[model samples]
Target: MIVVVEGISAAGKTTWCHQNAAQFLIKESYPEKRPDRQAGPGEAARIWTDWNAKRWSDAVAMERAQGVAVCDTDPLKLHFIWAMWQIGEVAESHWTAQLKFTRQALQDQRLGFADHYLFKKIDPDVAQAQKDHDAARSRPNFDLHLRLHASLVVWYETIEKVLSGRLNWELSETLPAAEHTPNPYRYDVSVFDRFIQMLPRPRR
Candidate 1:
């Protein structure tokens, strides 16, 4: 099973993966120098397209060997592209080429989509606090981060529709809604269990 834990920065994806003892990989762990903003838009998009395809291929290999793998973000680069565009970092003319690249990668089976997508929803205040406390790394401004997060949610919703019958997707939530206040900051273990249960069986 290949599961993706996705959300805005400071959404606790890495933390949840750690607390649950899942076989986890974080995107930042594989650091590549991204093309500078001054780079031509087409060049930057192409670079990220290739990088994301490779990342997805690597995760698929891990899942094949280990029976399970969890990624801290979606291997598809669509969300990244969307974020860059939202922040006016990418030229509009590059959109078509980038989308084409992503589609071709999927058709070629070079970039495997997640079997399940778990979207973490945290309170804005909590997320902001987490960002503020992380002094070592520079993060996007809070408003920009929020905008990116919203766009990601919409993107995943579209993915769910596109991948209907092929994949499972869910938001972090506890059962029996009346029993307790939903803690937006963390995912319940039940969410993990649900993912495991929904995994497709291997062929003989």
Candidate 2:
């Protein structure tokens, strides 16, 4: 099974992945080259889709070899953009462009929904304390992550509703094993459209 593990900063997701999924883990990465700073929304969307598709492909290869593969984050990360848009951090054009590009990637099978998702939900105060104590990694965006956490949870709730039984909404101390749940809508473009449509509309 392809399992995605996601959490905000200091949520212990990376630590859990390191301990349990070293063999079958696909670490998140950006494209080798950055897009132009002045690129338009469509151009940016195309670039991000390609990058995410590569990650999904890597996860598939790992799962084929090892019987399971764990990803540090969802490769089809449309939620980040939508969540940011939800809070008015970005303009709607960006979300629209990304939806167009990512849905095409799904239709092409370059990107598909994972068989399972594990989320690490933590108390904000505890997460803040953990962030303060972690000296090795400098989480400059920790505050931003805290702000985005609620919106992120809401995003995945919609996903869980749309693709039922595939998401474990909370993570425990140990990684949960995923069953071979046949995802009928894994590559369905209409499901992608529905998922996007279920998102909270961006505020004016």
Query: Can you write out model 1's per-residue Cα lDDT over 1-204, one digit (the tens) per residue?
Result: 666777787777766666653544534343358675355766766777788777787777776776556676777756666555655656656655676666666656666556666777667888889888887757756567676775566666655564454233444442112223322212233432343234322222
For candidate 2, the lDDT comes to: 0.85
lDDT of 2 by residue, 116-137 (tens): 8898778899999999899999
Reference-based lDDT, each prediction: 0.60, 0.85
- Clashing residue pairs, backbone N/CA/C < 3 A, model 2: none
Shift of residue 54 alpha carbon in model 2, Å: 0.4
Which residue runs does candidate 1 get wrong by more than 4 Å?
A: 21-31, 86-89, 133-143, 165-204
- RMSD to the true structure for each prediction, in A, is 11.4, 1.7
